[model samples]
Target: MLGQIDITRRQAEIADIVQRSGFASVEELAERFEVTAQTIRRDVNGLCELGILRRTHGGVEPPASAGNIHYSTRQILNLAQKKLIADLVAADVHDGQSLAFSIGTTPEIVMQALTGHEGLCVFTNNLNVAFTASANPSCQVTIAGGRLRPGDRDVVGRSAYDFFTHYKVDIGIFGVAGVDEEGTLLDFHEDEVSARQSILANCRKSFLVLDHSKFGRTAHVRGGHIRDVSCIYTDRPVPQHIQALLEGSETRVVAAQDTV
Candidate 1:
């Protein structure tokens, strides 16, 4: 078995490459990392055990599914990367801004990062985000009226959608379950899609926050396109084909690694 640190770093890199490219052969991975094919296999096996990657005949690819991972598990996955993306996003937000935040762990982190800002009005369906944003005494937090989703600590449904549509916000920050190969945003449930659509439509500036692992992942509920957002804050550069699509568009892609 590989050392804990080594295994984590290698597997994370491998997962990112496979997610962005759709698939990666063992030989290609071994060559790219200057490691033996056997070592690459070991890393692949570990990722497969985590259910994030599926083994192919000669390579690995993201698991094909419409369901998202457990919320607790998602909270810790790529946490460091999410924090970096959040910090960059919070830096762009000024005090006294009216913001709408959609549900997700990354959005919660962004709210946490904004707790120091004063005179902000935050609208959200996510209980976690509401609590975090309220930590700033000067910020006013409004949560939606809907049945709580205990698993995700958020609310979703017609009520959530209507709540977001009622207010026009200066900035809308949201996260998606996946970004398909065609650059469409996806989520596990129709309610999530509807709520996110309302956010995008009502905000003057929309920001999509996601880590690299979301790039080529699969989800059944389609909402919007990547180009629909005003800015994308992610941990890694987008795939080549996605980059080509964003060219000359109003959307700005900000990778934390490039900025730092």
Candidate 2:
């Protein structure tokens, strides 16, 4: 019986499952581990104590409130959806347009998608986006001066915020960690949040690119208000409440799957 497994080993497995799926109900975890619900609960409680998982209403999920997932991990998760969202956002961009990109996996994908576009001058705090956008010989890339965050490979600080204040762009593309029920955009870093706020304010048109997983998630910093975005390009429909919120604010919603 799986009941004979080592408690420590089983707990690790549970952590992996919760991290992978984002959330797992106690009953589901219990069945998978071939243990009683009480046993699974104990394992989950122990993991929670260790801060490996966070308890949810009926289950447990990865500890996300502290910060964002690692950049490497985010790059691999929901990859297909990210690609689709990128394509949708890119369609709105044209040659000779000035663009501003925010730091995020989805924005990186958008940069890759724009690799061949000509006469584009891009400004960004994301090193990866700046580098990728520069791959198109005709595109000029500008990096904002700020405190470089090696882990996320992005720059953010008062300097980055000041950098964006000097010029307005034709389009601003960004990704957020979460869009809560109240239609607030949120992220994990204070400097990054401030940088995005500057980008949004300085751009003529602002697009928010995100996968469906961002819905209902939580991030500690307030990025901005959803009403400020010109349009949202996502792989799937946003939550019904969010949709209504956008409509009321005169923001457009582009569901990539439906468009294709």
Best by lDDT: 1
* Candidate 2 backbone overlaps, count: 0
Per-residue alpha-carbon lDDT of candidate 1 for residues 178-218, written as tens digits (9 for 90 to 100): 99998999998999999999999999999999999899988
lDDT of 2 by residue, 204-236 (tens): 999999999889999988877888899999998
- Alpha carbon deviation, residue 132, candidate 2 (Å): 0.4
Q: What is the C-alpha RMSD of each candidate to the true structure, in Å?
A: 6.4, 8.4
Please state the error at residue 192 of candidate 2 in Å: 1.2
Top candidate when judged by TM-score against the true structure: 2
Model 1 segments beyond 4 Å from truth?
1-66
TM-score per candidate: 0.76, 0.77
Instruction: Single out the weakest 10-residue window by summed lDDT for candidate 2.
Output: 1-10
Considering only N, C-alpha and C atoms within 3 Å, which residue pairs clash in candidate 2? none
Model 2 local distance difference test score: 0.84
